[model samples]
Target: MIFSAGDGKESEPSTPLPPPYSGHNHVGDIEFHEILAGTDNFDESLVIGRGGFGKVYKGCINHGENLVVSAIKRLDPESSQGASEFWSEVQMLSRLRHCNIVSLIGYCTHEQEKILVYEYMPNGTLSDHLHKQGTPLSWFRRLNICIGAGLGLRYLHNDVGIDSGVIHRDFKSSNILLNESWESKISDFGLSKTCPTNQLSTHVNTLVKGTFGYLDPNYFRTGKLTRKSDVYAFGVVLLEVLCGKPALEELVDGEWRNLATWAQDSIKEGNLKNIIDSDIMGEISPKCLRKFVKMTERCLHDNTEQRPTMDAVVVTLKSVLALQEKLSMQAAGSRTIFGRMVDLLPFPTNGENSGRVEHNTLAPSKHGDGIVVAVKMLTSKTRQAYDKRQTKHIAELAHPNINIGGIFECRDSKHKYFNQLLFPNRGNFAEPLSWGTRLMIMIGVARGLTYLHLNKVHCDIRPSNILLDEEFNAKLEGITKTVTKETHISTWVRETMYYMAPEYFWNGDLSMKSDIYSFGVVLLESMTGRKAWVYGHIEKASLVDWASTVKSRIIYLKEIMDPRLNHNYPLQGAFECFDLVLRCIANESKDRPSSKEVLQTLERIYALNK
Candidate 1:
């Protein structure tokens, strides 16, 4: 409605001032003459805003040694309501100190001129940005601002260092001032009331007095003001921020509709898409959108008891922001990256396939208990986590190197997978592995790869995909399927392009030889304790080319091995392993040795170290 005429602007002009009345500028009286001189005797051009009380002006006043640019609010003496509000504002602001709440530099009371001086807000109010079409705020920025304001409101309701809690009688967008950085500062507090903390009943039986559209209906009906009334008003502001509409809008029929009523009505029918700000329609993910909309709806709930505490609201908003950021960082065409999706895939039915987990669990238990067990569902498709002693081995397949677990389905279409959480994991250079431990891991990896290449291809292979138990028994992980068609599957699996063989890169082939190529990358990573090179647009060479091209430059034997090993590794075996890695990462799949051959070579190298 453009209710406030405040249009704040510009800097403190470098001009001589006419003795600003020798008044202190720190939370005391700013002399009336100083304000007049600072605002050029209330010039029409300097007027920034207006309220029912009076106009607000941008003033440049000399305070002590420094000149400060401030927003000067001059109250009307004739209006009896404004007179009381002026005193209320001065009382509330003098002692209160919070970052999100605006800072009051000083006030003026000279024979009737009631003026408030505040730190200059350069970006003006949140209302101006949302409804008036100035700068477009991204969903991320909006979320942060809302969180900041929520924290401020929470402090007022509980954390304030006082005997009573504060209830902001008028909590709306216009009262939210945005600084140069767009941080939200809750401004107006003339109607704020302090509810006692020690009392059994927190409500104050005060006259109902808040803005029309944002006024709590319950407060109006019974003249009972509580903290929840402020929550209801804040809910209206949340809706305004999300939908980019005014709290009250006039329809074509000339009837006014409250934003909260319309949005809550749409949300009741399980729909918020229609009213969401079109500018940020696609920016909010489905998961984040559902969470945010539901929270906003609860904030507007009619029964005060049903509404969430400001603390819960703050936490939920933060989580929503966190989820949004994670999605933004997720690599394209991949459901999971690194170990993010590790605990979601199926648990192996046999011991041979139980080495690595392929999905992250819903909640990973922090206690370190060592046992490998598969999920047994007494009910259908239940995601229940049973750890350690409660789960037992039911697998017939046996291998000392392979982790064994069983998988059973009750009556559900989708099977539940569970396995032992390996303790003291030693992959990805978690800590440097000793020479003897390295040999054990290499041998296990070779045997596992040889077994897998017998039937299917492991699309993604990296150092992180290799898991080692406390005894250094290595097991392969990140495998999605025990078997798939040799060429392609129904769903596209995104493999790490950096570890991919040239044949797989160009021809889209997941041949058994591709496993050999990826194994080569893993082996190289182990020997050097460094990652295999990924191709980039600037440097188009693959790992094979780099290895083949730079082999002569890396002539010294010690230069190639990981220095963390302290040259403790057997020279001959280390030399042989390095050569083997070069052969596996060959440019052509045909040139790469078979998994069986790689395993045999690794076993031979293992024997040399002994």
Candidate 2:
């Protein structure tokens, strides 16, 4: 039979599927021999699904004399975060040996590629069996899958091999794999982290990570991650199993809502008929459905602290299955954070990933290049600010010998997955710049600044608004540096605090001479390998003050050179740079050299090194 949509014509699937397995019927052989052997034999031809980090394939691995078929995941090298996630999964799964949890037999990272071997689940993923076009599972089996997955989660949260205090940041149906015996295993630990038990708010301040539909709204707003975040995600997954709907979708009202909200609204109105999956209609006992919904409601409670623990959730879900007891399932409709409605709402964008296959927009380059580039994508607010600044301020910019390259705004591209790129020759900070490169950085930055200051436009400078390419070349990356009218008193004061000339800090005014003062700070940072603000004994902090005091000591320069660059820095070059820095940071901004003179001096330094 075929399905039809609005057009009334038989609608074909966008993609076709490979034929089912014909060679091997043995579950163990399919897992161990053909798959886990970790060969090219098991490639995309056997792939079952693709996700943010990698693709999942079906194969078999050799288990001694016996062959076991299994599922293997391959991580793409170009994936923005593939390497870190691959190792994280290895660390979490390799040590864990449990019945309910999926077992990690072996892994391989060859030629900048990663592959994970796991025991094959003939029954496929829980999401597929629950929502896919296949034989509908009995309510008993569905509940069994839930309990089994919950057990696996409980073990991860506590019992596993160790109390590493693991937080499975991403938990959903697609991640739950099922075996022939119908037992479930929770997989995917890419976002998982091991933290200290003493930590109070499981919510750590981190960059926003996780899928759109499953992400904890609270965690997204505050950047604070907690175990309750997982509970919220699990609640969504439970609703998916119960209702058989995608997490988020555009409804008739034009508002995007997830399964949790839909289920909640239905439960409140006593409209289970419309909410429950048609396949399991009339089969699930009223008592079981009520209990299960209550379990989901507890998991979805807005107050993460008030939500049942994974341990409690497991017990409640199990009791629902066995005792068929009814639960009150009362959840306050209006939760705090009403103001965050705008944030919780999903916005349609060109490129969005939900731990699934990328849209395949960017094509890979055929030629090999030594250089790699990294670009950070900013929000619309940041972009708009940059645009306004670009037209008003053609800021004068120059600094030490750092080289700066052209500034370009990034747009969504097929090659650009997350609208960010951190490439290797495009810039290098992990390794120390060589002495020759250091001199080049100084001269180049000075030249860029010389052009800016000489341009007749007033410009304010800050170090963070600077850029360095792979060759240690520095350039000004700010939208504006020049000023015509009296700059805002507050804005000038803030800028001065970071790279202020002594006079500018005391009284908010900036000039070309003041630029020299900030340049001195940059020079010191490059020489000493210390950040502008290092946490000191108790009170004092400031890179310039620290460097000045250290420069007076006999052994100071040696102490400050980056260890990665080795100890063989030329003394004459060092003294020249130090003298240049001291001149720039002189008591008065007027005494500082013009960027033109600074460039001349750095050019001499660069020549000397060569």
Candidate 3:
């Protein structure tokens, strides 16, 4: 069972696929001539990557009108593991279909030739982006990629493993490919092993396999391959992403060292700043950084028993992502921004929060109400692009559920614009909110959106754009502008894709129902305590898609409801809210309820509560 490197032993599929997949195993087999022709005779110039398996060429799947691009990984004839690894990848990837798992297009098994085709990944490997200095990934982007990869592993270890689970012995950054949309998909199942679910234990007594730096220490020492082995390797990947360093083997003091060991040593010494990538050190919030380090540390724990399961890892990473996002949007206790703002005389600077400001944020008030107003300073570039008429209109509006207060444009003596945009106390969806409170907040948000819809206001709505008060009252922000034009072009648009209606998401169409669709997603979040978008596993890509599948089944509906509710809330009320969410997120805009209707349904829910 030991499949050691350079052992001159051929690798093969660990487990034979059973019924359903047995017939389809050869579905992706392509003729050898077509692979060579598509790849221009395996042209050197067409090579996108090289590995132990052999060269991966950027090739076409079909010729003429049916042509499609693909990454054709051709196993070298000299490769000891060629036949074994080739069959494993073809078997596993052919049947697996998850958002985070890469798709296997087809394969060729000609005389003395082995080639496997995969869906072409335009953005290349995660390693290329993280360590090659190709493009610096923002903290948000890094968090997303990690979550996606983690979710993919979770599926392999948890859901997909009902009969037999997979252990990706080579789950390194280079093996993780990014599609055209920058979605991370785990690839290269050459070293994968399938274990039986009916077995009393989930370990395979086999030779250790994985990238040098990412290889699990416990597995390497004892040759006990389990799902935890993949967890250990992924910990190294997380460390690499966090530190923005490649987990390549390094030689120090005449002893070759692993990146995980080196980085973990630095972290143990409390040299966080020393290990953090200088480019993103200032970007990561203190709470987020601390939590990330803690999770990474647990993953690298030497005791195989202490290593968390992929399911736990996924959940922990999700919370970490939410923390980073919340802190970034609701940063407080910073005086540098206040120094740049031109505060009016009546609403003076208090130099401190008024204790009543929940989440350390302040809102707009009457000229001298003594509430330290939450002010955001607009950059010169953004200030230049402001739609003046829209700005004026947003500033003039007043509603209890709307957080926007006013925009002040007072210039210094030198004619420089010191623009101060004031919003009331800003906080995110509070975790402590009761089921009833969450429903009330959703109603308030619906009311706010309805008002904006009636007023012809257009804006993006998401969890971050919605603010809460001390009493859990909701207010909609992002009303004054749609900075889709000012942001990195696609960054803002990409972030809001989670809540966008299908019509607006696909085409350029935006309507009143679009806002309602977004409200539905937020309502979904409130009800289920789940994020609007989930990327780790393919089956649960978006909460809307996952929830809609079970909307008709009351038993399944109860399962998706927020666990924090303890099943203590009124079932009738929860069911009604769930139904409303389904209606709001209807695929077709015409099928979706209007903003006014959303508000009315929420009001009905609230009235029934009384």
Each model's lDDT: 0.67, 0.60, 0.68
Candidate 1 residue lDDT tens string, 517-581? 88887676666655454344432333444565559687787766778889988888988888898
Q: Write the per-residue lDDT of candidate 2 for residues 324-395, one digit (tens) a residue.
A: 322211111111111112122222222222221111111111111222222222233333443444433322
Supply the TM-score for candidate 2.
0.46
Model 2 clash number = 62
Error of 3 at 535 (Å): 37
By lDDT, is 1 or 2 better? 1
**Please, what are the lDDT tens digits per residue for candidate 3 over residues 1-610?**
1235432233434443332224233346688888979999989999998865678899988733579899988888876555656676777876777899988778787777777888899999989888775678888888888889999987877666468888889898888889887889999887888876564247887765667888888887877788888998889999988877778644444666567877888656434444666556556754566678778888888987888888788898889888767655544422213322424222445443222333313333222344434454343344444446545655655677776633222222221110110111346333345677777878888888777776554446777766665455666765545433122111232336567666564434667887888888878887877776554421125677668656555456568787767886777777788889888888777888888888888888877767
The TM-score, computed over Cα atoms with residue i paired to residue i, of candidate 3 is 0.54
Q: Where is the poorest 10-residue window by lDDT in model 3?
A: 415-424
Point to the candidate with the largest TM-score: 3
Q: Which stretches of candidate 1 lie over 4 Å from their true place?
A: 1-25, 77-81, 199-201, 331-610
Best by lDDT: 3
Question: Clashes in model 3: which pairs?
Answer: 11-84, 12-84, 99-538, 151-536, 363-423, 363-424, 363-425
Q: Which sections of candidate 2 miss by over 4 Å?
A: 1-44, 64-66, 161-163, 197-201, 250-256, 324-610
Q: Candidate 2 — what's its lDDT?
A: 0.60
